[model samples]
Target: MTGTIKIDNAPLNKFHLKITAFTFGSNFSDGYALGIIGMALTLIGPQMELGTVWQGLIGSSALIGLFVGSLLLGWLGDRIGRQKVYLLDFLLIAVASFLQFFVDGPLALFILRLLIGFGIGADYAIGPTLLSEFVPKKYRGSLLASLTVMWTVGYVVAYFVGILLEKAGPDSWRWMLASGAIPAVIVLLLRIGTPESPRWLISKGRIEEARQIVKRFIGPNVDISDLIADGQSEQHSTSFMMLFKKKHRTRTAFGCLFYFCQVLPYFAIYTFLPLIFKAMGVKDDILGNILLNIFLLIGAILSLWFINKLSRRTFTIGSFLTLTVSLLLLGIWPHGPFILVMLFFAVFTLVMSGFSNIAQVYPAELFPTEIRGSGVGLTNGVSRIGSAIGTFLLPISLASLGLGPSMIGLAVVLLIGAVISIAWAPETKDLSLDEASQTPESSSQDVVSSSPRKKMSSH
Candidate 1:
């Protein structure tokens, strides 16, 4: 078997499980940090006497921070190493989270939120790239997909926590914001001493170190010769521009577009569900938000179960199609009865949650070890741009165009995602890492060379 195959086909073990747990913690922290702000804003808005523009700034500051953090840290991870950058990001998050309690004004709070987002962005790029390099291909989809589930869980739990803590008088938002520090510090401690990626090492031509890590953490018998040998022809570097080269450009574009489309609607809706529900004239907007987030959490969990069962292309295309249809129904009938409006929201959330399964994992899978960190980071940064735009605009859209038009606009975004997926999504379901990461032209060549007739004739 090839070195990539050897790594991909290895049995899931204790080490893999531990890494998954740590990564899940990282994602959970990220979800909480992002989600808590929506609820906190209710109090922050009034107490700080902030207007729409300031609210948008406060809400999207982290995402803006995410854009910066993802690009800088992702490239840094590639240049320095995943392990070195891994723990520090969480340290930054924990510190920022704790500082949220002391923010006396909107500016201080926005800066703090931006810092927290920056840390989460770094983890976004590093966590999946590291996990994908370690896990077996058979379980890779589900394991990596679980990261989103944890994020949704974190998000849902944050809302529930916000509801419970809302009784903490006028100062509750401070505690809600600071609570994210708990998970961040815990995950940071657990991530300590995690080994470096062997594939990354092999790509760097540190053969002995790669072999030892594979043998120690993975297995003694796992062969890495194929991995090292294959690297001979690759132009190895961590440069951001490398992702745009002919070999990787299509994947780079596809990664950014699909991720951008997915999150634009998701973050926009979830980050301001309370505002949206109020716009719909829900009797109890808070309870409605709770129920919707529950659906979101459920879909994320189901995605973990279904990811390995379905092809990546199928999941990407099907979920976006469903999302588009559901949102279109809601957009078309914004004046409908409460039941119908919520039904559409439920359907949209479920489909989007399912789509989240592929979002993080797909980007990491698109590039080889040589630039995996940068590739995931770049796509992540672009996706943040979508999310930031959505979050920034949702309040204004709700205020100006009302709910109907905004929902239709989201449908357009999902429709675009569906079109992109149908056009570009590849079948990387059971392929080894090296095979899956090949550029389209190179991958097609491999299929032809490895065809049954060619193999039979050669024999």
Candidate 2:
């Protein structure tokens, strides 16, 4: 008789959960601030006496700063440690968020938003890396994806807050902008208590310290000594050029292309959604904004569910296809009832939610522990440049082409993203960070060598 054996997976510990919560909190703050800018720009344009050109510039200012910060800070995250970089990012975002209240004109607001974008751009790359490195392989996807959930919650909170404060008149936009400071404060306090990533420590030759952190969260029952030892042996002296080596070149290329296309459609749609609704005759701006938040929340929840269940490649492709189809449908039939508009918007949000959540996890998984932060940041920085372009161009498109053509253009961009995702991306689902970091070319070689070759009979 043959016996079946089952291996039990370890659950996350209290420390792991606590640290993840803090990370989630920080992400929520960053996401809330970003989401607010999208909606606020839509609502504040008329109220602030700003033209569409000025509005578009102000909306994209953060993205420009994000482009710069992600590159600079992402490199810094790898050179320093994930935890240390994350700890300081909050203060930067908080100070920037508060300073927005002092801005009196478009130029001033644009500069302040740029600073806010820089801080958020830094957090975007660092937050996911911190969460993924700290958790075990089994729960990493779900835990990291939960950042999307927190992000939705933050958006929802901002939506209601904006509505309530709208009654405070145009001046209340200052308060809404200032509210971003709260997350920075929370992150600052929580960061003081959070520890650095153990995986990062192991990569840096601080094995003993890494071991203690593992013991605290993973418990002393399992034998992690061997795993740590293996990591130490395989640790190569890392540099930025190492990311472009033959073995890693494909992954680096894939990461950059995937992120670039992903952001193009995402920011294009989001930055213009409220304006689209207004153009569609949604008279009540507050109500339209509230509906947009609802869709965002729904998308966040659905994304959290599918990110772990489905393959990363599958999710990215599927979401892009769905978004593309929805945008096409909206373009084909420009005039629709309120229900149809809501339905389409919901679909758009749902797909985007999945894209946002999965995108973060995939890039982090593609690089080694030592350079994971840089990998994520570089892609994010590149993606933000795309976002900056999209943000800058959307208003121009809307002015010249009208809503249908504008949305059709966005759908075309999403279709391109879907194709790139399918053709170039690898499936990282259920793989450990170490395993996921293996280049596709090397992994294919291993697969071929592992297979037994049959001897050919002599003819």
Q: What does the lDDT come to for candidate 1?
A: 0.86
RMSD of 2: 5.1
TM-score of 2: 0.89
Write the residue-wise lDDT of candidate 1 on 1-459 in tens digits.
534437777899999999989988767876787789998999989999999888888888989998888889999999888988887899999999999999999999999989988988898889999999999888888889989999898998899899899999999999999999999889989989899999888777888998999999999878777788887766677788989887888788889999999999998988888888888888878667877888888888888877878767778888999999999998899868988898999988887887887987798878888889999999999999999999999999999999999999999998998887776776666767776777745543342233233324433
Error at 415, model 1, angstroms: 0.8
Please report the TM-score between candidate 1 and the true structure. Answer: 0.94
Q: What is the C-alpha RMSD of each candidate to the true structure, in Å?
A: 3.1, 5.1
TM-scores of all predicted structures: 0.94, 0.89
Segments in model 1 whose C-alpha atoms lie over 4 Å from true places? 1-5, 233-235, 441-459
Pairs that collide in candidate 2 are: none
Candidate 2 residue spans exceeding 4 A from truth: 1-9, 42-48, 284-286, 442-459
Worst 10 residues of 2 by lDDT: 450-459
Per-model CA lDDT versus the true structure = 0.86, 0.74
